[model samples]
Target: MQVTIDKNSGYCFGVEFAIQMAEDELAHGGMLYCLGDIVHNRMEVERLNQKGLRVIDREQLELLHDCKVLIRAHGEPPETYALALRNNLELIDASCPVVLKLQNRVKHAFDLSQRQDGQIVIYGQPGHAEVAGLAGQTGNRALIVMTEADLDQVDFARPVTLFSQTTKSTAGFYKMKALMEARIAAAGGTLDSFDANDSICRQVSNREPQLAIFAAQHDVVLFVSGRKSSNGKALFSVVNAVNPRSYFIENEGELQDEWFAGAATVGICGATSTPLWLMRQVAEGVESMGELV
Candidate 1:
């Protein structure tokens, strides 16, 4: 049996930066608090937790008045930073540069739109950390559009500036944009669709095409990813669609021997948030199991 790993299957720049910041802080032996999971991957979070990184929520921040806190790569709202300052907490910001840029774009667009009697529309999941942060920039003026249906909440006659969460599906974003434009045109109203940024990180946007090729090259696929990662979920769908023999697992322990029972060639791939070391371990486990068989 042959085994292959996808070249792009591993931690993306954002997750890599966040994890490195956490590890650097932990190695110095100080009290470190992460505002959220450093990343969505449970294994990576647990590993950091073992190294003395404490994950805290808003309430926890309130209780611990004087402490050092690290903002996750997901990035929090300005109010969150304000609260940290009000509590006299030392801040260690680790927000991804891409997310930080999106936040700035949303804030700037919202500011300009508000002056011109326009609205800021965000294409993202409601209540998601990133969405919440972007919405906060608009002081709640930003409208969240998870689907074309959510467009009903906006005034079609007015001008709209659209932005998307960094991890949103590019295809879905374009479809929603086209639908909104169609609705406005049908209404015979003067609608200014200002900007539609494809804010999705390349780490995710590039995975679909790569997965399609990877799926075609292998007979059976072992996809490793944390269930909570949005990018992982998106990429997994692509892989499964292209290759029916694909299986998803969080780690080596979850790998079922039955998956390899009749397979001659295997391929291993993982999400952007997945660590390379973890994937290697899973591959090694698979190799060892194959030898026994």
Candidate 2:
């Protein structure tokens, strides 16, 4: 049996930057409070926790004072800063540059829409942290649409500016864009009248096609990812679509021997939120399983 790990799978630049900030703070020996899970991956979170990074919630944030709070790559709204200020807390902002730019763009569009009676439409998971941040820029008035059906909530009779979460699928974003455009056109609008931003990160957008091709080359594919990773679920769908013998597992314990019974080559891959060491750990498990096969 031959076992290989997808070279392209692991933490993207933003997540890497966030985790590195947490590590650096923890090494310096201070009370480091990460606003949320530093990354979606539990293994990486646990690793950081063991190294003295404490994850805190918004409610807990309000009660704390005079400590450093690290904002993860999922940027927070202006309200978070206000709250931090009231409590005299210092914010170690590690917000992704991509997300920060998107927030500013959304705020600007929202400001313009308010005057012209337009709407700010965001294509993302409704309650997602990143989406919440984007919406906060609009004073929480941006219409959140996770699917084409959610587009009905928008008033196409008025101007609409559309933006997307940084980690969402590029194809999915464009598909939603097309559907929204058609809806607006039917309501007597044109492409020139609507504003659409393809804001999905290039690093993530490029991986979908790469993963599909990688899955097709292997007899069996293992998709290693944390359960909370949206990109993991999206990229895994690409793999499953290209190869029927694909499995999603968080770690070695979830790997089943049946997945490799007749397979000569196994491919392992993971999401951008996944740590490289975790993928290497899965590769080691695959190596052991190959010996059994």
Candidate 3:
């Protein structure tokens, strides 16, 4: 059996930066707490946990005082920073540059729209840390639309400035934008649609086309990613769409020998949040199964 691995299948720039920062902090030999999972992958988080990187939530933050807490790649709102300040907790902000830029843009757009009596509209999953951070910038004035159906919540007469989560599907974002435009048109109100920022990271957008091509080269494909990762879902969709023999797995333990049956050529790929080491393990496991056969 032959096996191939995707060149682009590994930690993205954002995840890479966050992990490196955490590792650097761990080297200093201090208790480092992360506001959330450094990334979506459980293995990576566990690995970091073993290295003195602690993952905590809002509730944990309230109890701890005078400790170092790192913000994950998904940036937090200003309120989180305020909390850190109040608690005297040293902060290591590892917000992805792309997400940081989006946060700034959200703030700017909200400020601009506020002057004109308009509301900022975000096309992303509500309650997501990124969306909540963006919405919090506007003092909770931002409205989240996860689907076209969510458009009904928007006031069609008000001008809407739209932004997207860094990992959302481009097609979905555009579809929601079109729906918002149509709704305003029907309402006969002055709808000024400001520039729609395609904040979907390049790491994800570029991977789909590459995965499609890579999948074509193999007889079977294995896609590994965390179920909660948005990029994982998006990239897996592309792999399965292009290669009917593709199998999705969350980790090496999920690999099944049946997938390798009668297959001579196999390929392994994963989302940006996936660790390269995990993919390597999956590939090795698949090869071990082939050897036994």
- Root-mean-square deviation (CA) per prediction: 1.9, 1.2, 1.7
Better of 2 and 3 by TM-score: 2
The local distance difference test score of model 1 is 0.84
TM-score of 2: 0.97
Candidate that scores best on TM-score: 2
In candidate 3, the residue pairs with backbone N, CA or C atoms under 3 Å apart (3 or more residues apart, or in different chains) clash, namely none
lDDT of 2 by residue, 108-154 (tens): 99999899999999988878889989999999999999887798898
How many steric overlaps does candidate 2 have? 0
The TM-scores, one per candidate, come to 0.93, 0.97, 0.95
Residue-by-residue lDDT tens digits, candidate 1, 1-293: 67777887998898888889888888999889988778878888888888999998878887777888998888888889889879999888888899899899889988888788888989988877778888989887799998767999988777878888887776777888888888778777654555566788877788778888999888889899988887787788888989999998999898787777677788999888889888888888888786323
Question: Model 2: residues >4 Å from true position, as ranges?
Answer: 291-293
List, residue by residue over 236-255, the lDDT tens digit for candidate 3: 88889889999888887987
Worst 10 residues of 1 by lDDT: 188-197
Error of 2 at 41 (Å): 0.6
Query: How high is the CA lDDT of each candidate model?
Result: 0.84, 0.90, 0.85
Please tell me which model should have the higher TM-score, number 1 or number 3: 3
